[model samples]
Target: MTASRFLDVIVGVVRQHLPAGVSTRDLDGFMDRNRGLMESHIQRQLGGLLARLPGPGSASAEDPELPELWTAAKRTAANLAAMVVAAKLGAERRNPTAQERATLRGYSGWGGLSIEGAASKFPEGFPVPEARGLIHEYYTPSKVAAEIARAVRDLLPTLTGEEGVIHALEPSAGIGRMLSAFSGLGFEDLIWHAAEWSELSGRMLRALYPKLDLYQGPFERWIRERGPNWTGRLHLIVSNPPYGARGAAVAEDPDREYREKRAYAYFLRRALDLLAPSGLGVFLIPSGFLTARTGEMLTLREKVLRRHHLAAAFRLPSVKPGGREALFPGAMLVTDLLFFRARGGELPEVDTADRGILEGSYYREFPRHILGRELGQDAGDDDQTKKPRWGYQVEGEFSRLPRLVERPICAECRITPLLKELDPKLARNLRMGVMRTSLDLDGDALAPISPAPPRSGSAWTATWRSCRPARPRSPPSSGASCTRRCAPG
Candidate 1:
């Protein structure tokens, strides 16, 4: 049977078991009686369908959509089973109140389906089995993983040279989310290495790409064992390393004293050590790496910034999952794809300069703005001043500040987060603030001036006051200065 036909049959069976005018209370009884048969039947049907499909090598190029559909079906079936179980248990124990049940139902509406379904699909091998029973959890969403992979593709051409095979490594492969991106980038001949700690995930990875070299072990241990061989071997390293900071035991040895450390930092240091000259690395580290205060990070900055140039930083849109509230509460935290070229070689320094202005289409909210402007007829007058400014040059010390502006109002529109919260509709218009002036001065030195008087003879109103001189602040003596001013018109 085709996969589609199997799905239809499963859905049909579920519909038959669903009681008419079924109250939420009846779902548990219905599910308890049918869960086992449904799971067994679906699994058998799916297994048969999969058997008919081509095995990895013999399979004609499988449609990308096929895997997605398979994953979705698996998730849905698993979730339905979990919901039934939870409902049955809730009624049997008489532990949850009606209000609690209602709240659970609401939560189920968004989170329950995915959570239960994910558990069902990978019942034995979740990324972190120790924390499976915890109420809060973390996992990279498929879409976000795909976006990171897309960024890797964007960074590839810059990393590959005219010589040998491209060597890429993903430290925390996590079911090959970023590695899967390689398929889209047309990188079939490259040498790809991934280290995943979870045996289940490793098995999944092997099944997904049977030909690739995958290691099932703690990344740190794998590094210690393979570090020498990888030194100067990797041309590209990308990862969305785990964000846990608690002093937990390393995956390889439970007896070792595993001090508290950011996984990304360890991965960064390892990747740097492994990178070939003129190589590039793209990391999805926590935003805290950019703004946090710690001795380790300071040392890391000194080591990395002094050696490798930072190419670009792209902040992703905040999503509700991944303990985003507790870990990243800065409204939006900036996650970057740091690009670097190894030090001391004939290779030209990596171009860390922002190309948005030269391109004439760079905007922080470029995706939303471009879509709005392109699709809407009432985009109104083009506000050239609000164009995005290149903040920092790749050659300079890595710091949080703007460097160049192609348009006037760019600063106000791009930097101010409040505008979006206050009047989102106005935010869409792209014309609320005064157009900013193009000043050659650094961001910190520029003073904010009120709009010029409508006429020279007009009284100095609050709206047309003199420019406010920026206060002198203590600079990070070791790091680049963080001072930035609103551009003067």
Candidate 2:
């Protein structure tokens, strides 16, 4: 069925049975992780039942809406059973593929694989349901893409391969702005792999990179399936993931933090997980990932710090005057041009998830939130033993400092995180698709390839107004590079 039709059916089901809250903003779709999404769908439906009832401030159990809302919930649950049975009967009429079966298991489990030893590839072309209704998808304009690509150009040749081919993946390829940046640079032998949730975007990417491996579905499912095989095989991974969207919850990860349902979190975690040793990743994401301490985000910091090489994370202007970020709808978000690499061995930490201490500049948080209660507390030091807070207040400071801001408040940023550290030394390699034999020539014997020189098209300059609210703002100039952040207090 067409994606719109599927959505229509979903909407119909929500309106018919769970009419109290028909919107599926909290609904989950099929994954490439489609099945996990199905459970989310059911969960959202259940939530709607509560929505129909009288909320806070309403009189008690005798509320008139309770009966109708309760009935809607019951009908919804019963209708779901009937739909499952009808779907099963319909499936028996024609032969269904294994992927189809896995999708049905959505009411059951979540699972896929394109790994060499795996059974099959991820279910292709499945419409990824709305992970979280909060996802506001915006395309990266070419001007912005160019700026980002220039920064990534330098991080390339550091990850050289024998055949000179680079394997890169754009987990959320929308009209291929990132792909264009990839080819625009000096590289030609890129092994393009991309996934998109919508078929319309998928078709566009297919036209752009016809021969490249293009998978259709939610990226969470596609990448997880093939992740085992391609893990550490992709030299560079680039993406502007959907911000604030929910993803399938991973329940059994050892770190406990890996269970985040935030779509960007899922994408970033996987992006870091899939990079080959020293392979780079360029991401345009919300600034919050670095500073967020709630739930899994803190441990996610540990993962990013320990598992990946510390690279530059430049704050982008969210609302620069005359800048593209300012012109675009929903543009006033603190954004960042984040860079990192896959570290092979033990990597070091930039900061900690420590609480109360609040010493770490990047990741610390206050012991108690400033809920603005009438409690007589001050942001200043304890009156009994006052001391300077080093500009980091011991109270009321929260995690996710401005979430990372964009510059010019409005400039477009085109970037490329071109990386593929195809180490033949690693037991398994990408090009060879197997364990490397002794006969294979290590890249060391091959002449070294340098990063492509920066291409000059538009002036590569950007400026953001001084963040100091009361300070007089400086007029931005052409070719102005203002990366003044994290200065010592």
- Candidate 2: segments with Cα more than 4 A from true spot: 1-135, 248-257, 293-296, 322-328, 346-489
TM-score, structure 1 vs. true:
0.44
Give the winner by TM-score: 2
lDDT score at residue 150, model 2, on the 0-100 scale: 42
Candidate 2 per-residue lDDT over residues 332-389, each given as its tens digit: 4444556776643222233232221122133223212211111222222211112223
| lDDT comparing candidate 1 with the true structure | 0.41
Model 2 weakest lDDT span, ten residues long: 456-465
* Candidate 1 lDDT over residue span 1-489, tens digit each: 234324323443343345678743365456557766766776675766664663221122223332222343453453343344344443454444444332222111111124443455433322322342122123333344544443344335445644646788888886565665455323544578988876545644554455678888888777668754665556788777665542333454221322325556666655664665446777766544543334554444544543354454443433233323311221122343444554311112112232232222233423322111111121111111121123211111111112111122112211111111112233333222223333323432222232222222111111123323343221111111112122111
Per-model TM-score on C-alpha atoms? 0.44, 0.45
